[model samples]
Target: MPAQVLAPAPAVTPPRAGRGYWRRLLPALAVLACLTRVPSFTRPLWNPDEGYLAVQARILAHGGQLYETVVDRKPPLVPWLYEAAFAVTGSGSLTSVRVLAVLAQLLTAALLAALARRRWGDRAGRTAGVLYLLVSVGLNPEDAQAAGFEVFILPGTAAAMWCADRRRWTAAGVAVGCAVLAKQTGGAVLLPVLWLCVTSGAARTAAPRLAAGAALPVLGAALLTDPAGFLFWTVTGSTAYAAFSGSPLHALTRALGNAGLLAAACAGLLAAVARAPRAASADLWLWLAASAGAVLTGFHFFGHYYLQLLPPLALLATAALHTEPWARHRTAVLVSACACAVFLTWGLTAPRAELTHAQRVAEAAARRTGPRDPVLIWGMHPETYWLARRAPASRYLTAGLLTNYSGGRDGARVGERYAVDGAWPVFRREMTARAPALIVDDSRGKPYAPAHVPTLRRLLTDRYRVVGTVDGAVLYARVS
Candidate 1:
């Protein structure tokens, strides 16, 4: 017989090359997300934002109304999300909320991967997922790792973009609405979603569906909360809160500095995108612009605000990297790694004494009061309420409302000039109605010291006596 000639075996592609591979790899990616944030699990509080949300959530879980009984300027969903997490993991478990934040981070990575895979290829998808997992927590671990509003909003905003890419108009709108419920800046996602619709000439068909879908969550939230209070805190009052009362020169310098730092941290990814044959798509450009607007909204330029920029940037960067040569790809990777190392090292090693001090004050306050006894913190450390597991004596979690000290500006110069006249009466009524059993003054003098306010000074002098001082916080117990 003639030598049998076997045809060259067809190129065998590994299972990972298949379309279903990304879906199968999702679980592993989710695990990566959790692993990256493990440090968050050890700390009870990473930021004051978490402390405020935790305290408000506890109040909500205990049948207190949102804006009425417990006050915060954020939208209602985050507190409710925290309440749900508490229900599952037991009340006051900061660890559980951190877990919830990890889950959100995982979902966002998955969505970004799926979107990239649909648009480019499997490699791009995997790169996007891994890049997001690394960079999201790389900027400032203290803020990024916390179960803050920024962490929670990413999943919703990313989902909206994924749905929009698929032309699922109604679902995309619903996702945007949910994102807004997490934070007002989240609504910035809607601009890109609408841009997609208009660019595709589907505005007529998609716009109405998008509107209807977006209304579901907003209307639902309104029904569940005090409508007037919800509007005031989330919308009306936010006007004043968002205003830039600080010096224009200072604002400009800070904006440039923060923006530069963020750009430097993502230098590799930005370079890859710039070098790609096909630059970012119009919708993505709009998405980046919208997210940038969101970050600059309050002119505060906080570290975590930069998080809103990551999803779109990750997608753009990974998609661009897919077509780059190996040498260039290696260079991009090296730059990004160095940047991440610097930021992560600084964030992880930064002193946590302030948090430790807050914990000590809470412990001191707890020793002097019962679990149900209401306690008031004269300073801005709402974490004390959550740590001590005591109800707040007043709805004002921080003295910002009373002192008119905007977190966005120099608290000293802007003090009292912008103080809400209406808040003082409400504070007096609530404090008089149910006096706190303990008062923890963590003000450390100057801005929010009770001595600065005659009313607060008299109340402290007449009703309470200093029992102890821990760190810088003074604990006063009610005289029997």
Candidate 2:
């Protein structure tokens, strides 16, 4: 018989308490995130939707209904969220909104850190949190200037990521509900939810969780803000205009644009997943869902739609870096540093709303005029008129469609095409009736609202004589 020597019991090192560390760490990270995200918040509120959403929030806080006052046909989640922020902050100023978006980004980063720790352990999560802070430029409420929809989608999707990974159907459903209520693009989670519904362990557990989770929106609607006009916006407001995502064939064009590198990356991920079936389920879900969102947004939606993918892509990128660092076992730190740098650069340089000197000059002109002044802004943010503490000149507003929102045929088409093709005829009519006294149209973002995205129709330029030029914006006065 081989003598088996009894091995001495291994000594276990006592775990250190994290209370002190967490106490010191959280506020520092939060301050860092706030500093980066709040600088140019005014940029996002400048977007049309932000103005709409902000108005709705103010209305909601005053216990007002949406359809009665605002063009709020969508779900009331965003307004209510804004209301809560407003209540706590006691201000309806856009500054409060920017603060909320920054806070949301911070919380989102914290949640991502939690998810990362569960998947990759403590170190990676902390690293991800720091990275999130450093690169959270667009995650702030100021993002409303660019597109608040993406920020709205992040929290719920991140929650969904957490719940799905834990195989908690109800939790995922709740997250999905909040997301959907926040923004329409959140419906993108349908694919992953379906995947969860089909799996075995998920079969029994997922349904009830889903039902419970669904109650959030219903509850929000009943107990909170009731946006009865939501359906109207979904059916009418959303499609009233043609999408500007690089045109109809944009999907094919963008796909082909990055065909070589994208294909290789997807192929690589697919193979790796196939080989590692036992890998962390949360990580896999994050990667696949994000990849799906990227492909869907890139191929299906307009370039602006890329805003939807920021959070997930952030997580996916973090996870990929974490995994690769382990495999390569060398230069992991260097690679992470480089990735952080890239993210920071992207955050800082992402396409955002900005007012040029010309815009400022037009603003000055608008200021020179009073609310009683016939301030015609055919091609600019009408709010500039309102904000300068002035009012607009006419009832016919230049927006997505040329439909008669008030009444009468107005001899203009209603579909989204009105801006792209219908604008010339409509502008001619508006010029005939009430040419704007002032105009401020961008060379980017909503500038293309009337002119279409990617390129503006120079033909529309013929209707207006340039009163002033600001940055990429051209302020127009009706050519007599």
Candidate 3:
């Protein structure tokens, strides 16, 4: 009797949608992305490193000069973006450029979400987007303050992946090229794309695909941006930085960590690719590209430089976070938080070395300098530029990368090339000819005085006399 009654009780319906399904989830996540990434609308000077970018952008926007104006090696896309931003907003302050980062990052988050749809379906996609929004929020404080293209790592990766997910080679190539334009390090992203094509080419159903579509845009960007700049990147940015890393394990360790974390994160992506239906794994080609970037850029790799690989990595992390039990994600987030705090503090503080030196020189020189009076700098650090910001009074003297700092190996290198390229000509033709009243050379350094370097001292010969000196630098004048 009880069984008969139960049978008659009618069937209960199953609960189908979770409270935050993918469709409902994305908008909310987008809002959250905007909130975290868009705060502090208008504050902070451009970080010194960023100043070069801003200056170059102004030069390009006005068509002044490309490689000549900005001696730094990278291509011209970031500066161009900054110029266009200035055009529309009519604001050239560091703040205006920062807003562009927000937009780039937002688009990046959206890209990650689209990528997720390919990997884990809707839920994973939305969650990955949310995580991207979170990552953008926690960028180094100084990073938050600047308006440069470094933050595009995530969005750019996402864009490439988005195109790959749809089998859109031309669009994918354009996205990859755009990413490279944003940062030279972004060229590594193509590995993922090629991997997909090659893997697919093996299948009977999959036809031979055009790899040139992706490679061509990046090649075109290199040509348009600066053929010389690309060559310089190979010579200076890549090779020199690699050589620099040889002196310090710091660069090597950070690179290993970035690669290891990326690889661990990518294992899940590879798994997802394996589990995916045919043509499904092409979407993961973005991860391959990002990993390639991590490997190549490990040489001069600053944390901010690693930003390009982060979005795809985070999406892969989302897959990990989603699959793993509670303990791991909790551990990962906490570790990431602590690391971020340390990183943010360092980013905000590290520039002080150059900034303070510049401030001191500027203040001191401002007191003594006249517009027409020539000023000469003898030390080897590039501190004069920063100091010059405050004290534009004296003309900077010295050649082939002179420092405002009193001592360094760079100063040594100039001496090594003295007879061939030295300040002797500058002294006779520029400073002595004009008879400047003051020459400042920052003499102080961690190890010792740069003024003591024989070449610098030797170079400051009979034509210019030592008038005065300071804690770190010194002042010289053409003998009057």
lDDT of 2 by residue, 1-480 (tens): 111111111212223634554566578668766665544453434454554465456555656665443443346677666767778876435667666667677777777776666555566566556655543432222332342556666677767766765667777888888877776667676555645465534466667768678666755664443333455554445453323333435456544544432322223232333343232344445445654664463234333344444444445445555566455322333443454444344445555444344236446656545545555444435344434543334332334433322111122333334443233454455445654455555434442344442222442476656666555556566555
**Best to worst by lDDT, what's the order?**
1, 3, 2
Q: Would you list the rank order by TM-score, best first?
A: 1, 3, 2
lDDT of 1 at 146: 81
Give all TM-scores, in the order shown: 0.90, 0.63, 0.66
Off by over 4 Å in 2: 1-25, 38-52, 55-65, 72-75, 79-93, 131-147, 193-202, 222-228, 235-237, 240-304, 314-354, 357-365, 368-376, 380-386, 390-398, 401-480
**Residue 459 displacement (Å), model 2:** 20
- lDDT for model 2 comes to 0.50
**Tens-place lDDT digits, model 1, residues 344-401:** 6666676788688888888888898998899999887788888888899999898776
Find the 10 residues in a row with the least total lDDT in model 2: 1-10
- Give the alpha-carbon lDDT of every model: 0.79, 0.50, 0.51
Best by lDDT: 1
Identify the leading candidate in terms of TM-score. 1
Candidates 1 and 2, the one with greater lDDT: 1
